[model samples]
Target: MFDSRHIRTFHAVVASGSYSAAARLLGYTQPAITQQMKALERAAGTPLFTRLGRRMQLTEAGESLARHAETILGTLSAAESQLKAYARLRTGRVRLCGFPSANATLVPEALSALAAEHPGVQVELLEGEPPASLRRLERGECDITLAFTYPGLHEEVPDEVVEVRLLEDQLTVLLPTGHALARRRAVHLADLAEERWIAGCPRCRANLLHECAGLGFVPDIRFATDDNLVVQSLVAQGLGVAMMPALVLPSLSLTRVCGRTLEPAARRHISAYVRRDHLRIPATAVVLDMLRQVAANRVGC
Candidate 1:
């Protein structure tokens, strides 16, 4: 059986025109190249090369072998490329869950990139809050879900779930344009006690209250909504202030509400949560890598 190594050595020596040059290209010693050639000639039952004044000249047998080597190598390379393409186009369905805030940018961009690369792969997206998304994943209703941990109120994800941290979305204060705290460089939890707060949802509000209590005061909750857009719109109307993660910044669509980094620097760590047992799937692995890369690029990491 003619091995790939033997064929490769033959191709390299013919292309480089000398054993020393071919050895340099292949990272093999000159003696090793000579040995490979001798082995190949022995297998072929003929002299492949003639020694002429320290240089190598191809015999008729060598010329014939070289032509066959070229075709064989080309065929092998094509086969490898086709295998890679098949893997890239692996047909499967991946169910993904995420919040609307993330859907604004990172989630959608990563999905678009994945779709472009793997057209045969089918992806189903479900939009919901983090806790709901996590539940869906835990129940095996979805393959992966986007999750986040707010300051002082970390949700305990199950040990059976593997979480891949995508990015640290720094928490920012969303205040109206004319608000007193908005004029300053940044606001701390202690600085905004007098103002009313716009909460995201009941769970999000509960999390906010817990985070605020850690800072020593409960914010007066004037309104609450799961919609970040609505929360920003309320803030713009001078209804109340809110905090949002950096993932929500790019597609906020509200010019009146300004996003400023909070003092004492809080951040929500966004991650991809998947069942540990199902990670062997290549479709999920490649998509997860793409999400991490996109998130890192956005945060200057």
Candidate 2:
């Protein structure tokens, strides 16, 4: 029989893609992780990975074993969570994931409150984009993920996952104080077609174009940035206009930029997602309630 620890180490290595990375993530030394993989290979009677330069790739047999390992690990996690359910907030770690904007505005405050109310409960924060956060949640890396949904993107709630809407965030047009539209109370999407735009990313650019096409014309993008703070700073420097969610408005450091709510009330709705398998745990329920309460209080929704 194969040891469960070996199976777990093998899964972590496959998920992380390197022995060193897996070791770091699992809090084990490089040699220990290597030995576990070797033991796993011996138990399975086949090699699991092939080293390619500095990286490692799983073999066909390894991939098949990985699938089974993932299922076994997931089942074990579910079992442990079930056992811990009775403890409620008395103990357990809550892994939370979200983008920087959410981190800036609500995440810290909410986490503080959670810590204060449940001192025995440990909290972990992970920052990333919506797609990445969702992937972490799916991978069991995070217990919960606060993710954003644009206007056209449908809210996808699979049977395995549950999404609770936190807030309906309005989009605001950000412009420098000296810009022509900065003095306006509101701006139409069509009015900015000729103006230079600062996009969030390539995906953001595509999404922006798709949204603006609804208003009759595409934007003239002059810059692209992954950092919203930099985008705001540049807009304050008279760079270009950017549309962003109001939930992140309070975190903007640029005082020279004005945020005007757009017409038709374009918005991104934020949601907290959890694995359906773990939702029944009491600690998970309490944390979810706290998140919902925090959002309702912060946004006054």
Q: List the residue pairs that clash in candidate 2.
A: none
**Model 2, CA-based lDDT:** 0.82
Candidate 1 stretches with Cα past 4 Å from truth are 1-86, 151-159
lDDT of 2 by residue, 22-89 (tens): 99999999999999989888988999899899999999999899889988989899888866755767
* Clash pairs (backbone) in predicted model 1: 200-225
TM-score of 2: 0.68
The CA root-mean-square deviation of candidate 1, after full C-alpha superposition on the true structure, stands at 10.5
Deviation in Å, model 2, residue 38 alpha carbon = 44
Tell me the alpha-carbon RMSD of every candidate. 10.5, 16.8
